[model samples]
Target: MAWAGGQVNNPTQADAMKSRLQAIEQDLSKNWEKRDELNRTAERASTELKEIQERGIGLARSLYRYSAKADSLQTRLQQMQERERSKSAAMARRQGQLAATLSALQRMARMPAATLVAIPQPPQNTIRSAILLRATVPKLKDEATRLADELRTLKALRANIAGDSKSLAKTMADLEKERLSLSFLTAKKMRLLEKTRSAEHSAATRTARLSARAGNMRELLWALLKQKQSPELRGEDFEPPPAAGKPETATAEPPTPPRQTAALAPFRLPRGPIPALGRIVTAFGAKMPNGTLSKGVYISTRPSAPVVAPTKGRVMFAGVFRGYGNLVILELPNKDHVLISGMAKISAEIGDEVLAGEPLGEMAPSTSSLPKLYFELRRQGRPINPLPPKAARRNKVRG
Candidate 1:
């Protein structure tokens, strides 16, 4: 009877252990699948972010070029205006000369040709004077006509400049609108990235804590099984005897509540946008040629691009740190911190509470072909992998 009972109990125990192991494996597999999905989503976002940033940069460059063109046009217009003023002065002098000439002709016309010839003592001298007057009149008439044509040309030039000025003003307004739109889109992308990262961080933390608790439980079970003494099984381990009228298969087990561990504690965190628009030039933990690993990432951006606050945080330190120029450190609400370095200038001061998307500074040497910035996110004074799991795995394998 003892041998038969032992055989039945052993199979049941073995089957239970096997089922538990299968369940654990399934949980692990699901966790990995969720992580992979998240990684893929992050990659897509990063790619789209890069494209949006590029578009923003292109718009900014266009705006700058157009601004220069507008300035040149304005200067040319000013010169044309000056020329117009000078032409007006010349027209005024021409009008005065024409008026004097007309007055003299009127006076001469009032005296008849017969009267003038009768009063003159010498006929040959008078005839010469008349010939000179006739030649002078034609010359004055030609000069007046030439001045009129010049005035018309000046007026046409002024009109053309005015038209160009109007067109340029319209172009500038349109370009400004486009630039503003790009800025808005870029800001939206940054917000999306921050929200995704925050959610993923929370989920991952909970999963990791749960996995650790599960591992502890498995170890405890193994130790219990290995003990030489036969420990009394708790009443919770045994199923109640089948009810008198109901078949065993018909009795349903009550579901247990989920177990919560201390590690699953929640903390408040601020969600915000990325500091700048750029491409990831170097990833975290990259092995350098000098055999040292990188603790943070480097982003390549356009010259003079703005560096903004990634969250609502207080500036802990805002100065140059060794090996990192123009650094600004922000301490977040949960005590997690972020370091922004390699800036051209610093706008925020220490102890200043900066809002998300607030400008911290402009990128240094904004015209570099590849202006790089260093960024790090930290928790409890330790740097963790900020990249998604898939990218981290690939990077690790490559390394």
Candidate 2:
């Protein structure tokens, strides 16, 4: 009876252990599923962010073109209006002159031929007045012809001004439309950034602390990289492979390469096109106001001009730095760095993988002065000219 009882207890304990193992397996399966779902969500968000950025950039370009057209039309309208005012003033003066000449001619015509003899005036004086009147008739005729021509020109100028006003109105409407579209895209991007950053709040907090403590950008970057390598900030944990005898139960699909590779692969040098639509006001190595050689280029951009990434890179820093307003630093795949500064707003966040031409930020809107963007490319911690070879040579020659 004792042996039978022990056997019964043993079976019950074995059954309990088996049930617990099954529960553990189920939990592991759910966790894997959750991870996979999160990955899918992240990928979708990344793709959506890219699309929104591309569309926003296109709209921004359209806005710039339309704004330029509107400016041109406004300038032309002002010139035409000025001409109209000048023509109107000239016409008014001509009318006064013509009226005076006509009145004198009428008085001369009304005077009877007998009156000239009856007035007891000298014959020489009367003959001289008659000769002057005869000469003035041709002059008056020429003046009338010239006034008519000016009136015609004034009419044409008014018509052109009206046309330009209409064109300007149309261009402004298109610009407004593009601005609205860009605003929508920008909002979407912000929302996506918020979502992406939410998951890494702890890491971001740690990075922020590091940034605060670091003395400069170089120190900050080094600290960030070091923190990223730590387990707590890695945000990923992988289970060791099953022991040799066990069969593999799950396989992860290899990650697809980033979309920016194709666009970035062709460039041998880190320098791509200028990151924004603007004129380069200060070239690399130029003398700055402080009498120091400029380490980067300064671009005089239009108000609220869209700023894009110059090349494919991962964001290392995206925030304000000492003396630099709204700065961003990108780490290229080849271990190079690019720094962009002086933006009014930064759209990219730290650790974001950005593509070439991806919208990164915008210049501040300013009516008083054109905003300037600063761009620098660094190779192994040394500043290099970001201009193309030909452009660099041209700048050198100019200098």
lDDT of each: 0.58, 0.71
- Residue by residue across 276-376, what tens digits does model 2's lDDT show? 66567888878788876777788887677777777778887787777677888888887767889999988888777877667788889896999989987
Clashes counted in candidate 1 amount to 3
**Tens digits of per-residue lDDT for model 1, 1-399:** 124744645767778878999999999999999999989988987777666545644554454445445556767878888888888888888889888877877777698888878964798887776777677798888987998798888889889888878977886676567546645765675576565555334432332233233222222222222221333333223222222342112111112212111111211111112465555667677776777666666777555555666656776566654566677877777655677888887766654556555556667554437577777665444454443334333321100
lDDT of 1: 0.58
Instruction: After superposing candidate 1 on the true structure, give the runs of residues whose Cα lies further than 4 Å from its correct spot.
Output: 1-19, 114-132, 196-399
RMSD of 2: 11.8
Where is model 2 poorest over a 10-residue stretch in terms of lDDT? 248-257
RMSD of each: 24.3, 11.8
